[model samples]
Target: MIEFKLPETRYALNSDVSVAYQVTGDGPIDLIVVPGFISHIEFQHELPGYTAFLRRLASFARVVTFDKRGQGMSDRMSGAPTLEERMDDVRAVMDTIGSERAALIGFSEGGCMSILFAATYPDRVSHLILTGCFSRSADRLSEEAWEARLEQILRLWGTGELTKSIAPSEAVDPAVIAQYAKWERLASSPGALRTLLRLNRQIDVTAILPTLQVPTLVLHSKADLQVPVALGRKLAAAIAGVRYIEYPIGDHAVWTSNNETVPGDIEEFVTGRRDHGLLEFERVLTTVLFTDIIDSTRNATAMGDERWVRLLGEHDQIAREMVSKHRGNLVKSTGDGVLATFDGPGRAVRCALAFGSAAKQIGLSVRAGLHTGEIEMRGSDVGGVAVHAAARVMSHCGSDEVLVSRVVTDLVAGAGLKFAERGSHELKGLPGKWDLFAASG
Candidate 1:
């Protein structure tokens, strides 16, 4: 492991507020990590997960993280800073570090500020990454629910019990719970958190998502207790050409559960490649294929349980064989079919075609769709907008049909592939009408 000397914490003035920040590494890329709700630059280094996340980022880019106004070492004002004021703090940090432009990463509540910054100053952001985030505060909780929650937060602002809600994975450990309690106390005063929460309810940046020109990656936990996966999907859909990845677990804190994977994903996005070896779960840019046995429900009803199970097993085996033959990874069995990924769109398309033909040999017809994008590798399963988009495309296809997105069509240009336009159709839960194509040969 390469040793990194801790960088000195510094401050950037955003008018009356002094935002505390730290900058580390000298990688070619300039990346800024925006915090959620509260942060303390010095205190963060005490937590192993937080430290590991920072070092991993420093390994590939000159990383910058700061305490937003009214938190940590920054000036604690009488009230919370609005979205535009928060944007000024980001600009001040960039100016302090002499970073004319950089990639912005927003986690949780920080995502809202990042979105506002990126849309307001497109030329200053090369890319944007959001994790466990939401565009509208109301989407997270109802006003009545939020008011009740706020009352509770006020009653137990620094009791460390909130750790159970924010970082349930670490709440069980007494030492972790104690540290979180102290960390919360030092992160901000009770008065600040109250003001911030009240202002947070007014945040709604959904309108700006569509205007963002910078490339983006939106990641959310499938089981996130605070921010639902649906909200993250909504965020990605609103942004043109945005990539979305869903982590399997629900920990909202980036420093828990799959903390390491978070930075690795950011590295791949900004650096264009991963520095580590292949693992069961790691974010990577690839093509995803979704296939399902057509009329499986009806067939299962007619075949009886025992025979249906046997046929399903056989179908799974055939799908695995086809995926392996085409150099694809069978991510998981989707009951009636399977989901797989390939390093290239051509291979993914070919694998889908093979699955369709091979399934027909066993008196089964399959529908499949292929799409290319960056995906989050979660142990044995995969989740991302590409995965969902492929499934949507597959759902639109008929028996024995292999369909693909425009991204796939463009990538497999000369791979002896032929596609017929299926016309532009609206994919459920996704923004805009997607132009789809069916693989004719």
Candidate 2:
């Protein structure tokens, strides 16, 4: 029999709304664990698996778990709150604890909010740990799949049937499954659950990720049914300098089942036992390329559905091949455009030039922008003011043209990639003025 000594649960810093949390252990480092959908700090310790996981984490650091705003002990609002608002609740809990900085451990939907926090408030975080997370809600599951899942939640979430849909496996102990369903019902109202799910579907943090400067560890079960593992991989790739660990557990709730392994990985990541393999340089240099199709919407509408799909496939193949030829990594596809990264500014410039020239033959024109600067690497993508600057530069150019920032010019001075200065321009969302130039033919 496991005798769990439960910690005293308390409320912290009441805004118009207050957040509820519990503090346990007396380790040197402060660790804050954000809940997924429904969490009650007081009730959590009663579950054997949940209790064991927390105790394990507490061995290395003081653990803090909190109910998110509008759920559990926190005040319930009339409407669904934004991810930013939920993050404020997390901040409130931290402030209450007098924590200068803490390692953030977020599970499931909590993982998305955690990423946003670490990116938005790098100074407040010592490290970030995300499990089963996605950069955007749209990318996690397809539209049809999302609708189906939502329907299941709405129909069965509180009916003691939610566990049937989420158990680690069919062989899971019935007692354990019933315990989870009970917690789900106790921790949140149906309205609150629906609202949280809505927010999860609409959340997008792809743009803000590159600005994150803290050490990050991303973990996801390769066999997770709720959130696909590819989304996790995409998240890791989008953020520069992120360490990703893939586990084989199919459960979305890691601490509940297959409990030991999940918490152990988190403990290792938080305690510095695992080297995140981050390098320190005064300035890290990388090339940024932004490519957009010419008259994309018009082309899609004109070509109709079938023909347009075929054309886009051809365009994707061409762009991918050209990007690969120049040793560029395809960061992501932005609707009709593609964003890529290169090791050398010169290669990026040449790739953009070649891509633009080749695109015209296919009745397409690509606008590109290149810059080199110290970039914060999240798993697969490069980010920071530099990445945004490159995107802004791309916006100013016309179809079939490639532009380069002055920083890129300095890096590839004798690379034979000629450029004609476009002079200074004020870019939106960027501080100060920037010097821009057009790539020469």
Model 2 earns a TM-score of 0.59
Q: Candidate 1 at residue 82, lDDT?
A: 94
Per-candidate clash tally? 0, 13
Misplaced by over 4 Å in model 1 are 1-4, 276-441
lDDT of 1 at 71: 89
- Tens-place lDDT digits, model 1, residues 1-441: 112357889999877778999997787889999999888888877653676577667777888999998889999888889999999999999998899999999988999999999999999999999998999988988788889988988788777877877788777666567778888899988887888989998999999888999999998898787788899988888989988888888588877768667787877887788773344226667899999888889999999999999988889989878887765788888788788988668878888887888888888989998888878878778887778888899889987899899988998899899999999999998889999999966
lDDT of each: 0.85, 0.78
Question: What is the Cα-based lDDT of residue 424 in candidate 1?
Answer: 97
Per-candidate TM vs. native?
0.62, 0.59
For model 1, give the 10-residue run with minimal summed lDDT: 276-285
Query: Compared with the true structure, what per-residue lDDT tens digits does model 2 show for residues 78-123?
Result: 7777888888988888888899899998787788789888888899
Reference-based TM-score, model 1: 0.62
Estimate the overall C-alpha local distance difference test score of candidate 2: 0.78
